[model samples]
Target: MGTMVISGTVVLVVLGFGNHTWWLVAVAVLFLYMQYGRSGRVGRGASTSSPGGSGGGASGMTPGSYRAYRDRRDKQARWERRYRREHPMEARRQARERKS
Candidate 1:
């Protein structure tokens, strides 16, 4: 199933990386499998099982969704901060648009 596909993809990526001596691809796949696959499943399950899923189904906002939203917001904020440092005037224009 999903595991088979993941394994096959990992094998292909590793084989492709063999041309170079880069072990990072293997490490990256391992990390992605461990953190993303498990946590994503758990998050999806939790969100679907929560209350107020009246009609929104999987797209409904739950604790898991809020956590994801907050995480995205924080990441966006970090990027915006960096962008502002690089282009202060553009950032100011964006802020003005938001105000309008």
Candidate 2:
């Protein structure tokens, strides 16, 4: 599925270049970048483990690391909640300052 889409896009870009349509070539390059460049799945020097592999999940996060990440995020959330509850005025002031 993905291959077919990419192949079709490449064909279009090639055809555009053959016809000397500079704008089409530019648009094709931009489209390809928008489709693939911003996606986090394609990172340089990053290794992705296969299904049922020795380590890591589908998103390349290992169990221990995922747990630690979640714990840190939860702790931060709890601290923020407690801070907002205990220092509403300070929180509000900080928010206002950030907005400006």
Candidate 3:
């Protein structure tokens, strides 16, 4: 894919020079930047998952990460409890349906 993009840019720049079309050259430069710039690097590097196959990046299972995850989970639980308190009939109906 990168090779094809580079080849296309080269062709575009050559055509731009041959035709004296500055916009073509500018477009070629833009394509090159899109193919090789920081955004492109990020897209390429995003798949570097840990060996654990969690697909959550390298620090996913660290102690600090676990603590953070636990804290987030607790906060979500508290929010859910508050929501249930605010909507007791909905919660009770859902719970009753689950029992059935």
Candidate 4:
């Protein structure tokens, strides 16, 4: 689903470039970003889980566990950003590895 959205966005961008209608590309990108946010694949602050799962509360995570999860996520993101900045080639290689 994500790949399809990305490919569609790329096609829209190409079409917009060819036709001089930049708004088409902008709208496609905006729609993709909104969908990404709604999908919960990149969340912040709290961890989401099934309601009936262990350690889950009404909001899907117990307060303490949620805090821990958020902390870990933040730490990892920070490290990733730093790594990417410091070792761009290595970061790209690792990303390719993970994708495969």
Candidate 5:
């Protein structure tokens, strides 16, 4: 993590001062920063879980579950839309899926 930040900063500094085409360096730095943030290695060490289970990097909540969860959410959204259209009164009466 430290390595990533240091490398990214070095690249940025070089790009700011050097005459070479530093786009690649900038890209590399961005990639490293993203990697670092994704791994939760910035202020703290890499975590076993990410902000969302959708991130394809190394984390918990298997890739299959991520897809399944997304699909379920989409399906739920569709159902909500249909329910609202079919039964506007019920939709206005109470919220579906209570807040947890």
Candidate 6:
């Protein structure tokens, strides 16, 4: 499949240089396909698999991105917990204000 795309693009590019400038249009479209097509399956990190999901339905999240997102959220939660624990008075004041 990779070879086919490269070969077709090369042919279109070569033809585009000649009188058939219209071939370049097809080449441009093909280039876009290659760009978007390859972007989704870049590396293992950009896997098609759903992360932390069931054996069904796609989560539409790459494992690497999900891991990074989860790590960031967990770190923030831990920091917030520590801050609240140390500042019980402030935490209670904020909680009370939020309830009203």
- The top-ranked prediction according to lDDT is 6
Off by over 4 Å in 4: 22-26, 29-33, 36-47, 54-57, 61-100
Model 1 ranges with Cα > 4 A deviation: 1-64, 97-100
lDDT of 4 by residue, 41-62 (tens): 5434445564348763346564
Off by over 4 Å in 3: 1-64
Looking at model 6, residue 69 earns an lDDT score of 83
- List candidate 2 segments past 4 Å from native: 22-69, 78-82, 85-88, 91-100
Cα lDDT tens digits, model 5, 1-100, are 6676677667776776665556666767667667666544453433455446555644544433455477678999999999999999887767654542
**Model 6: lDDT of residue 11:** 76
Q: In model 2, what are the clashing residue pairs, if there are any?
A: none
Give the alpha carbon lDDT tens digit for every residue of 1-100 in model 2: 5566566667767777668675476576666666666543443444444334566443565333555478679999999999999999999999999999
Candidate 4 structure lDDT: 0.69
**Stretches of candidate 5 exceeding 4 Å from the true structure:** 1-64, 95-100
Q: For this target, which candidate reaches the highest TM-score against the unseen true structure?
A: 6
lDDT (0 to 1) per candidate: 0.66, 0.66, 0.66, 0.69, 0.64, 0.70
Q: Candidate 3's error at 35, in angstroms?
A: 14
Clashes of each: 0, 0, 0, 0, 0, 0
Give lDDT tens digits, candidate 6, residues 63-90: 5665658867899999999989999999
Model 6 misplaced stretches (Cα beyond 4 Å): 1-64
Candidate 1 lDDT, 1-100, residue by residue in tens: 4586477667767777655433556566666776557656533335544544464533455655665577679999999889999999998999999999
Model 2: weakest 10-residue lDDT segment is 42-51
Which pairs clash in the backbone of model 3? none
Q: Using alpha carbons, what is the TM-score of model 1?
A: 0.31
TM-score of 5: 0.31
Residue-pair clash count for candidate 1 = 0
